[model samples]
Target: MLSTPISLPTVFVGAAIIFLFALALYPSSLLRWFQRKRYQYEVTFSLYMLTPTEKFIFNSILFLFLAMVSIAVALYLPRHVRIIAHRAYYYVSGDLVKNGTTSAVLGTTAEILTPTTVAEAIGSA
Candidate 1:
């Protein structure tokens, strides 16, 4: 059977047989898959269904985990970077207040920015 040449029709028939057998074994699953949902909701398990004590414990553990992660991040990351990020996040000045742009400018800005002292432009490279 394994060595036999398999065609589409033979494979399909075998699948149909298996599916029909499965339909008998698990009618609800088959129905859910084949049937259009009358109302848009599914019967499923959820943690929200947990008891009051379980929910409290779960939330406590979750918050504790989140706090630990927050503290770790705060501790692991340097202070200056955090300050810069915070400032960047809050800064609403909007793009340097002037769109300083130049078309077809290749390192001309670098030349302008570099100060020429004693007839020798400070080595850019």
Candidate 2:
């Protein structure tokens, strides 16, 4: 059976229909968001009283939150990447053996002796 790809206009029409249906069902929700009043919070420091604008506080919070998240990712991502890469290396080794290609050299060595046994043997010597 031949499959036909949906066109761009078809997707737009479907989206429009869904949007109109949602608008019909809950028109107030959209209006509530658009017509909502901005909330302001005052921060009092010892030197100065600052009443930051809603947008400024929101932007600052967003920026600081994202910055912290980025820093955390930078600190932790390498460990995860190294673990995944190590697993992938072993998986590729097994695949190479199955495919009758040159088996990974490290994989052959690992098969001869488990890592802990090899470490203990080496340490005893």
Candidate number achieving the greatest TM-score relative to the actual structure: 2
What TM-score would you give candidate 1 relative to the actual structure?
0.27
lDDT for position 75 in model 2: 96
Which runs in model 2 stand beyond 4 Å of their true positions? 1-52, 94-111, 114-125
TM-score of 2: 0.36
Q: Root-mean-square deviation of each candidate, in angstroms?
A: 16.6, 13.8
Structure candidate 1, residue pairs in collision:
none
Candidate 1 lDDT over residue span 21-112, tens digit each? 98788778648765535223222324446786876787689789999989988887776576565456536533221213321122243323
User: Pick by lDDT: which candidate is best?
Assistant: 2
What local distance difference test score does each model get? 0.55, 0.60
lDDT of 2 by residue, 1-125 (tens): 63998899999999999998988778686576654432222222221243446556766887799999999999999877876666677576634333212234323432345567545655775
Report how far residue 33 has shifted in candidate 2, in Å: 29
